[model samples]
Target chain A: MDVRRRNNVVVTGPEDGPVLVLAHGFGCDQNMWRLVLPALARRHRVVLFDYVGSGRSEPTAWSEERYSSLAGYAQDVVDVCEELDLRDVAFVGHSVSAMVGVLAAQAAPERFGALVMVAPSPCYIDSDGYRGGFSAEDIDELLASLESNYLGWSAAMAPVIMGNPDRPELGEELTGSFCATDPEMARIFARTTFLSDSRGDLDGVSVPTLVLECAHDAIAPREVGAYVHDRIPGSVLVTLEATGHCPQLSAPQATAAAILRFLEHPR
Target chain B: MCRTEEDPEPREPDGAKDGDRTTDAAFSALLEDSVEELYESAPCGYLSTLMDGTIAKINSTLLEWLGTDRETVVARKRFADLLTVGGRLYHETHFAPLLRMQGRITGVALEMRTGDGGRLPVLVSSVVKHSGDGEPLLIRTTVFDASARRSYEQELLRRQREAEEARRQAEEARRQAEADRARLTEALAALQRSLLPAELPVVPGLETAVHYHTASPDRLGGDFYDLFPLDGKRWAFFLGDVSGKGPRAAAVTSLTRYTLRTAALHDADPAGALGTLNTVLHERYTGDDPRYCTAIFGVLEPDRDTGEVTVRLASGGHPPALVTRADGTAHFLPTPGGLLVGVLPDPHFVTATTVLAPGDTLLLYTDGLTEARTGPDRTDLYGDEALHAFATRLAGPPPGGLVQALTALLDSLGDGVDDDTALLALGVPARPGAM
Candidate 1:
C-alpha cells in the first residue's frame, strides 16, 4: 500500500532541516495546524497528515475494529515514519493525539526523539481520585451530539456550506471539506477518543517531553494537564494564555514558541 | 350621501373634502403601530450576538419562547449556553466552524432547553454581519419551531429501519429453503442407488455394461437394473421402468427388483422369473392406483467350445432387444404380442432367444430411449427404427463401447429426453486370446 496516499501525508519545509511531525486531534483533520505551520516550518521540516477516515484521506482504508482503540492511530504514526524512513524526529500531537504520540514513541523508540503534547489529556472520564474533567455520561452525550449533527454533515447540506460567497478568504477547497468526515467513522473516533485511558502509559515516556495546556479548557482542564506532567518524569509543562481545547488555533504564537523553545533547550 | 346636490354652489379652489379626511385618519392609525411592535411580535424568534457568541440583544418573541426575561439572558448567556449539551457539542465541532467559514448558514437543526426542562426542537439560520471594512462585527440569527417536522422525520427513520429488518429476514428464509432442497436431493440420490446394483457381476466369456439416466434431481426416477449369478454356469439380468416417477413409483421399482432376483434363484427359466414378479405386483397393488412396469428379464449361458453366449429373454410389453453383428449388421430380436406386467390377472409373457457370436453385442433397454423427442420442433419420437439404424451404424463395437456411445447420444438429447432411461449390453469377445 502507498502509505503516503492512504494517510494524506503532506511534507513541507527546508530539505535538510530537522523533522517535526504534526498530528491533529479529534474533531478535525491536519488542517488544524494551519495557524502554526508558517511559524514552525521556517527552520524545521514539518510533516502533516490526516488519519484514515478524516479530511482528504482515503475513506476506504478505514475499519471499525482497527480504529476503535488508540493503538491503531499510533500505528498510523509509525507507518508514516517508516514510509519516509525518518530518524530522531520530533512528534507534536494535539488533544487525543498526544497520547497517540506516547504510544508510537514506545512502539518504535528509535524513530522519535522528542514529544510535544498540546492540550493533551491521557484520560477524559473522571475516576478514582483523578479529575479528567468529564463524567462517563458526558462522553455518551458527546456521541449523541455526533449523531444529531450527522444530518447536517450529510451530502444534502454540503453544497450550501461549500458555496460561500461572502468569505472568499476561506478558500473554496478548505471551506466545506475542512472537518466533514463520514458520520459513522466519526462516531467510532469519538468513542475511541473520549473513552480512552492512557494515564498509565505516561510514566513510560523516556524522551524529553513538552506538555502544553490552555488556560481555560473545558474538555481538558488544568488538573488533567498537571496529571499528565506529573506522571511523565522530567517533563516541562507550560500553560498557554488561551481558552478552549485548541490552543494552536486560539493562541498559535504561544503554542509554537513553547514548542520551539523546548526543542532548543530541553530543560 | 346627497352632499353633491346639496352643495351645488361654487366651491373654493383650495378645499378639504370628506374622503380626504377619512384617508388621513387611516394613515395616522397605520403609522401608530411601530417597528418595535413588529420586531417584538414577529412569527419567528430573533436574536443578535457578538462576534464571540455572547447574546447582546433578543426580541420579546424569543425571550417568551425560552421562558426567560431580558435581565437574565441579555448579557449573561452566549448562544451556546442556551443549547442542550449535545447541541452545544455540535455547535462547537461542526456548526460554529462552518458558520465562521461560510459567513451564513441556514436551516441547521438543533434542540434547546426550555425553562420547564423540556426540549424544544428548532431550526436556526445565522448570518455574520460585517462592518464597512468587511471585518465581522456581530451575528444575527433566526429560529423557527420545528417540533412537527422533527416528529415527521423520526417516523420516516422508523419505517426505514423496519423495511431493512424485513428484507434481512426474507434473505435468511430464502437461504434456508435452498439448503433444505440440496439436502433432499442428496437423500434421494442415495435412495436411488439402493435400488440398483452397485456394480454388475462378471459372467465368464461375456462382457456386460449398463447405464441409467435420470431427468430430475428433485424427483426420484422409476428406472432400475441389476445383474447377478443364478447358478454355477448361468447369470440372470433385468432392466425395467415403472409406470410413474417419484417415491410412489420408486417403491414399486424396489419391489420388482427384489422379486425378480428371488424368483430367478428359485427357478432358472427367464419366463418363470417374470411370471412370479407379475403375480406379486398384481396382488400387492390391486387398488385404483395400481402400479405396473415394463421389463425384460434374461439369462445368459456361455458355450465353452465356441466362445459365444446364448441369451434367453422374456419381455412384458417391453421394447425388443437389438443384436449388432460382427459383420456390421443389426436387427431386433422380436418378442411379439406381449402385454404390460401386473395389468391383468394372467399376463402373457413372450420369450425370445438370441446368440451372441464372436464380436457381437445384444442390447436391452426401456422405452424411454425410443419415446424421447427429437428433430427441430422436438415433436418427433426417436422410435425403434431410429435405434436400429443407430445401432447398425456402430455394429462392430464391444458391449462397453456400445453402451458408452448410447450414453453420449442420451446426453446430446439434453432436455428433450424428459423421462428416465436404462440400457444394458452383453457381448462376446471376437478373439479368445484377447479375452
Candidate 2:
C-alpha cells in the first residue's frame, strides 16, 4: 500500500513552511493533536497521521510481527517521510509516540531535525536507581481496568476520550471507534506502550530534542522527565504548569507555547 | 403605610420582642451543637485541601481512621502525605491532573497510611469546590472503607488465575497424548520392518531386486515376498497379498511364507508349491471367519551354458507376470484360470514358463501394483495397460533398473496407493556378445 494511504497522512499549512509531524500516543489517534494543531499549523506545515490499527489508517496492515516492537513503528514514520520527500522534519510525539519518535530519529537521522516528547518516559516501571513512578502491579491494574471498562462499549466511549468538537462523522468511520482502534488492538497497544523499555535508545539520538513533562502527570512523573532529559544528550527539559497527562487537550496555548519556544532556540 | 426612621419599631411591641428573643436563642443553640456533631461523627471521612495539597480542615472521623489527630493533619500534613507511597505517586500524576481537567474524580481506589505506618484500603472521591464565578477554591474529598471490596476483587483475581492454570494443564495433556501417539507409530514401524528380510541373497548369473511399499504406518499391511535358493541351481521366489491388514493379516502372511518355502523345497515345481500352500490354508481356516490371499510363486533356473535364465511362475488369483524382452518390448505372461490361493479346497494353480534371456527381465508382483489409483480424482487405477506402458518405458533394463523405475512410478502416485505392494524382479544380465 502507498504509505500515505496506509498511515492516513493529513498535511496542512503554508506550502513552503517548515514541516511538523504530530504523532498521537496510545489511547487516541491523530485527533489528539486537534487542540495543538491550530496554533502549530499557523507557523509551520503540520502533518498528522495515525498508526496502523488507529484513526483512519488501514487496519489490514497490522500484524503481530510488524508491531511486536517499537522499531516497526519507527519504520512507519520513516516511510511517511520518504513518501513525502520530507527532510529535516520536526517531530512532535505524545505519550508512547515520544519514544517512537526517538527511534525514528535514530533510524534515519537525516529525515529528522528536532524531536518533542510530551509526557514521555524512557520506561514505565520502576527499576533499580530509576523512578518511573509506576509498579508492575499498577500497570496490571490499569490493563484490567481498560479491559473491563472499555471493551464492552468502546464505540460510544471513544468520542468522549477523543473529546474533539462535535464531529460524529469522524467518529463513525474509525476502525472500532474507541480511540479510533479495535478494542483488541487497543489492549495490545496499551501493553506495548506501558511495558516497553527504550532507555538504551536515548543516548543515540543526535537531533535537538525537547522533553515536555506536565505537572501532576501520573503516567510519566517529574523524575521520569528528568531521567529522559539526562539520557538524551543536548536535550532540553521543559516543565509545563498544566496538570495532566494530556496538556495539549487541557492547556493547548501553554503546550504550543512551550514547543514554539523550544523550536526558536537552537540549544 | 410607610414607616419613617422615627417609627422603625412601629411593628414591634413589647410582647412580640420577648417572644422573638427566646426563639432566636433556641435556634442558635441547636445549630452550634449539631454542626460540630455532624462534622466529627459523619459515616465517611471528610477533608479539605488547598490547591497545593496542604490539608486545611479535617474531621474527627478521618483523623481517627488515619490514627492521627487534628493538630497533626491540619496545616501540617498535605493530603497526599496521608496516602501510601504508591498512592501518593498516583495522586500526584494521574489523580491530580484528572481532577484539574475534569474538575472532579470519583471512586478512585487508594491506600491511606495510618500514624503507626499501617495501611487502610479506601475509595476516595474528590471535587474542587468553586466560587460563584467558577474559580476552583479548595479541594474537598471523602473517603469510604473499601476492605470488603478489595477482598472481593482479590477473590475474583484468584479464580481467574485458577482458570488459567486449568487451561494450561489441559494443553499439556493434549501435548502428552500427541507424544504417545508418535511413540506408538514408531513401534508399529519397527514391527513392520521386522517382518521383511534384512537383505536379499545374491544369485549366480542373475540380477534381482525387490521393493515393498506400505500404505500406512498405523497398521502393518499384509504384503510379503521372499527369494531363497532351494538347492544349488534353482531359486524359489514368491510375492503375495493377503485380503486384509493388521495383526490377523500379518499372522496369515507369516504362515503363507513358511508354507511356500517348505513346500517349494520338496516339490521343486512352482505350481506344485502353490498347491501345497492352498491345501494348508484351506484346512487351517475352515471355521466361521474365512481368510484368503492371492500369490505368485516362481522358480528361477539359470543356464550357464546358454546365458539364459528360465523362470517358472505360478499365479493364484494374482496379476500376470511381465516379461520385458532384450529389445525393450514388454508383454504379460498370462497365467489365467487359477483360483485364489487360500479360498478353494482343491484350488488349481497355473504355472507359466518363460526364459529370462540375456537382457530380459521377469517381474512378479501382487495386484496392488496395477490396482493403484492414477487419476486426478483417484477413480482410475494404474491398470494392466498402464503397467505395460510403464514397463515398455524401462527399455528392458536389468532387474535393478526396472525396480528403480517402478519405485519412481510409485513415488509419483503419492496419496493414491491404498494397499501394500510387493514386487520381485529377476533378470539375466545381457552378455557382452549378445548386445
Candidate 3:
C-alpha cells in the first residue's frame, strides 16, 4: 500500500557515461532486455525498468487509456529520463517499445538524443498507400481467435510475433510467460497492441532515429521496418542478420551489435 | 367415334368355344381398350406447324375449344393462320425470332376461330426437330388448356401483390426502428455531451485540438473526455471509458467525471485525482456488477515564457495522449501504469510527466479510436500504435485539425461504433517563425 512507485527502476553500466534507456515492448518486461544490457551497460549508463504492467512491474496500475497505446510506454522513457535527470538519453526500444520511444522523444524532444527502433510496426491495417500486412478480415479473424482461446492465442501469437512459430518451445515458453501474468490485463493489452495505429506519428520524431529491421520477424516484418524508416526524417535504417521478433531473446549478439552500431553513428 | 361392342359369354358359347376362345377375348379387349383411350375432345386448342409455319396437323381438342373444324386448321391454313389478326402480327415479330434463336418456344397463348365465330384463349408450345443433315424439318406443337393456368397465374399475381404490400409494411417498420434508434442516439449523444466540456477554453500558449470518434451513433457509448479549468494557471482533462452500458455504466462515468474534476479542484494533483475517482467507483459499484474504467487524467500547466505546457498525467484505465509538434511530428505522451478506474482499493496508476514545447500538440482520446472497426484487409481496430501514427501526421497542423480529422473518422464509422468516444487535445501554438 505504501508503494510510491518511484524506486522500481534499476540502472547499470558506466557511472558517468551518457544515459541510454532500453525499453521492452508489449509482452515481456525489462527482463527481456538482458542480452543487450551487459553490452550497452559497459559503455553507457544503462537504464532498465519494468513497465507498470509487465515483468516484475506492478500490475494493478494498468488502465484502458494509459496502456491502450505504446505512447504510455513511451512516456515511461521520458518520465524515467526526468526522474533520473537523464540528458541526451539515447533510447533503444524493441518492437512496440521502439515505437513508443519515437513518440516519447517527439513529445519531450530535449530529453532524447537518438532512437533505435528494432522490428517496429506503425500500423497493422493496410491503408490506400500502405500495406499494413493484414486486412480487416484478417484482423477480425485474429481478434476472434484471441477471443476464443486467449491463452492458446497468446502462446500461438508470441512465436508468430517473434516470427518463430515453428518452435514448440517458443509457444510453450510464451504461453507460460503470458499465462503467469494477469490474463485479463494481458487480454486488454493484447487487443490494444494489435489494434494500434502509430503510422501518423512516425514523421513527428525530430531526433535521429535508427530503425533496426529484423529479417524474419513475424510481427514487425521487413516492410514495416522500412515503413518506419521512411516516415522518420533522416532516420537510419539497419537490417539485422538475425531472425525473430525478440532478437534480444533469440539472437542477442546481433541485436546488441546493431544497437551499438547505431549509437556510435547518429544521422 | 363409334364404340366397339363387347359380347357377353354365350350360354352355349362356353361349351362350343373354339380351342383359342378368341371370340369373347377379342371383343372384350377391344371394348376395354376404348375406355382407356383419351378422347382428346377439343376442349382447348391443339395443333402442329411445319418447318415453315404451315399447319400440318390439328386436333379435336383445339377444334372444340375454338368451336371450329379441322378443315379450317389443317394444310389449308398455316398455324399462324389460326391466330387472330393481332396474334398473327405478334407471331411474326417478337415470338418468331425468339423461337428461332432458342430453337424452342413454349406455352404461347393465341386466339383461335370458333365455329360460332367466337374467340378462345389457347397456349401453345413448339419444338422443332431437324434432320441429321441439319435440314429444317417439322415443328411438333402441344396445346394446353390454359384457362385454369391463367387463373392460377392471376391468383399468383394477386398473392404477390399482397406479399409486396406486406414487405412494404415491414420495410416501413424497419425504417421506423431506424428512426427511433437515430433518435435514441441523438438523445444519448446529447446526454453524453453533458458529460464533457462543451468546448475547450483557449489555452493562451497552446494550439489545442480535440477529436472524438465513437464507432456508432445508435447506441450510447462508454468513451468520455473533458478539459476544464482546475485553477487559475492549471487545467485538468481526462479521457476514459466506463465498463458496461445503459444507466449503470453512465452512472459510473458521471461519477468518474465529477470526481476527477472535484478532486482536481481540491488538489489539482493528477495522480491523487484519478485515485480519488478510482476509490469512489470501487466503493459505489463494489459488488455484483463491478465497474471499472481506463482514464488518462492530465494536469496541463502552461508556461507563458517558454510557451511550453507541462502535462502531468495519472492514468486509471485510459489511452495515452498523442503529442504533435508544429514540425508536423506526432507522438504519444507515455503514461504507463494506471489501473482501470474502479477495481482496486489502492489500484496503481502510472504517471509519466513530460513537457510539450511550443508548436507541439497533445491529443488524448478513449479506446474507441484504436478499436474502430475498419480496414479493407483486416478488422480495422485502430489501436494505439495507429492513433499515434495518425497524430504523427497532424503534427504541423493547427490543433483544430485534429478535431476535424477525428470528427470525420467518427462519422465514417456510422453505426459500427457501438461505444461513445471523447477526445481532448492541447497544443503549444507554433511561433510565427516556426509556421
Candidate 4:
C-alpha cells in the first residue's frame, strides 16, 4: 500500500524501535521539539503530528463530534502508533497534550508503556480542598474573558506561557500566538480546557508516569502539579527547577536531561 | 488756599469738635453691638461640651431649635441625651469615639429631641478644644437648623433614586435585548448543528470529525458549517465565516449554508457551490451595509478499496487546508487569493485539491485558528507553522478522537481566539502490516 507524507520534511529513523511520539501544547507544533527531538530520535523511532484544526491537519477533517473531547485526540495517538505498528510508546505531551496522553492511555492502557507529562494540568479550576488553585469564579472569568475578547485575551495570556522567548520581543509579539488556531477553534478549545473536569482522567493514568512541574508556571501552579502526582499512585512527581509553562522551550537542556533520565529509569 | 508751615494748625470750632467726637464714639458702639448681636442671634446654635460629653454651655439659638430650656439642659443633661432615641444610640455607637480620636467631627446630621418630644433635624459641627499643653478640654460645637436643607436634599435624593431606577430599567431592557440575541443565536446554532450530521456520515475508507464554535450570542457570529449527503458515493461539507457579526452575519451564514447545499444538490462542484452562495449574499446585502464571508466548501469522495478521499475545495477568503500524513509529516495545502464573498457583484473564489491518503488526516478551518493569539515572546498570532506541528501529532487519530483533541487545543487557547471557529478533520485507519 502506498502512503503519502503530509508535511514538508519527514525524518526516517529505525524501522523497529520503541516509538517516541512528541505532542505539542497550545500555540505550538512539533517543531518546538526540534531542539531536543534529534537526541531522542537517535535511539528511538520518533513520530510527530499537528493537532486537528491546527498546523497541517485538514480543516475539513475536523468535526465537533470527533474533536469535542481530548479523549478523541488520545485515540488519535493510538491510531498513529498502530499505523506504525509501534509499541511500548513513550508519549511526551506538553501542557494540554500532557493530560491528553492520560486520557488516551485510559482508553488504551495496553498500548502505552509510560508517559512524560510536561507542565500538565488535569483541571485548572480548583475544587474544595483541591489545589487546582484557580476558583470556579476564576474559570468563569476566564471563559467570560475568552467570550468577550478572543484576540485580546490571547494577546494577554499567550505571553504568560511563551514568556521570554528564545529571542527578543518584536512589536507584534503580543498578537503572535493568537494567530495559530482560528479564533473559533480557540473558543472551543478555551471552553474545553477551562470547563473540563479532567481530574477524573488523572486517576486513570496508571502507566509509569513522570509529571514535570515547572517552578514558576503561572498556568499550572505547584499545588496542582502535586495533586496530579498524588492522584496517579506510584507515579513519581518531580518539580523541575526550570520556571515557565514551556520549560522545554525556555530551558531546553535541563528539560531534555530530565526526560532522558526518567525514560531510562522508569521514574 | 495754600497755608505755610508757619500757618496756624488746623482746628475746628468747639461745637464741631465736640459733635465729631460724640459721633465717632456712637458709631463704634453701634458697630460693636450689631456684630455681637449677629453671633448671639444667628439662625443656628452654638455650645460647648466637656470631654465627657456633658453639656457645658448652650445658646438661645440651640434652645429654640430643640424647643428646650437652657436651664434644664446645659450643665445638667449630657449632649447625647439631647438627641432623639435613634440619634442618641447613634451618637454613642458611631459618633462619640470618632470625635474623641479625630478631635473633630463635622456635618453629622441628627434630630434633636424637643421638650415636647418632637425631633428637629440639625447639622452639627464639633471640635475638641485643646489647652496650651495639648490636654483635651471642652468640645466646642456649632449647630445649624437643617430642616429646609434636609427637605431639599431629600427631594434631590428622591429624584436621583428615580433616575437610577430608570437607568436600571434601561439596563434591563438592554439585557433583554442581549438575551433575545442569545436566544436567536441559540436557535441559529441549533439549526446550524442540525444541518451537519451529529456524527460525520461514515463513507467507507474514511474517519471524519468536525467542530464548529460560534463566537458568542451577544452578536450572532457569521460562522456556519454543514456536513450532508452529496450522493451515495460522496459527502458534501462546508465551514464559513461571514464578514460581519450579528443578525446580518447570521443571515449571510444561513444563506451560505443553504445555498451550498442547494448547489451541491444541483451539481457537486465545490467552486460552483460557493459561487452560488456568494451570488446570493451579493444580491441580498448589496446595499450600503454590505456583508461578506470567507468559506471552505469541499466534497469528500472516498475510494473505498484504496481508502482515500479525493478532496476538492472552494475558498472565499479562507485559510488553506492542512494535510498531515500517516508518517507524522504535515504542511498547509495553500488555497490562497480567493476574493471575499460579497466583495464584488461577481467575485471569483478559488479552488484547491488534495488527496487524503491512508494514515493521513486533513484539517480545514477559517482564519480564526492562525489568527489566534499567542502571548509573551511569541506575541504574534498562532501561525501556520505551529498548526502544522499540531496536525503532525494527530495525523493518525479517528474522527471522534480528532475532534476531542482539537476541542482541547481550542480550549487551551482560552481567549486567544476571539472569533467563531470551525474545524473539519478526516483520517484513515491504519491498514494491518503498514508499520
Error of 4 at A153 (Å): 58
Comparing 2 and 3 by lDDT, which wins? Answer: 2
**lDDT per model vs. reference:** 0.84, 0.79, 0.67, 0.69
Per-residue C-alpha lDDT of model 4 across residues A59-122, encoded as one tens digit per residue: 5556666666887667666666666666788889987888888887777777789999888888
TM-score leader: 1
lDDT of 4 at B335: 77
- Listed in order, each prediction's TM-score against the native is 0.80, 0.58, 0.35, 0.37
- What level of docking quality does candidate 3 show? incorrect
Error of 4 at A106 (Å): 73
Q: Please, what are the lDDT tens digits per residue for candidate 1 over residues A90-204?
A: 9999989999999999999999999999989999888999898778776787776575556555553566557777777667777566777998889999899989999999999
In model 3, where do residues sit more than 4 Å from their true spots?
A1-267, B1-190, B215-219, B376-380, B409-418
lDDT of 2 by residue, B334-402 (tens): 989888987988878888889888999988777667888888655798989999998998888889989
As a whole number from 0 to 100, the lDDT of residue A236 in candidate 3 is 91
Top-scoring candidate (lDDT):
1
lDDT of 3 by residue, B156-223 (tens): 65686699999999999999999998898788878777666687777667666666544443345566
Stretches of model 4 off by over 4 angstroms after superposition: A1-267, B1-199, B217-219, B345-348, B376-379, B393-395, B432-435
What tens digits encode model 3's per-residue C-alpha lDDT throughout A123-188? 766789887665665445443323323323344334333433222232333333332345556556
Query: Which rank order by TM-score, best down to worst?
Result: 1, 2, 4, 3
Q: Write the candidate numbers in order of decreasing DockQ.
A: 1, 2, 4, 3
Pitting candidate 3 against candidate 4, the one with the higher TM-score is 4
Calculate model 2's interface RMSD in Å.
Answer: 6.4
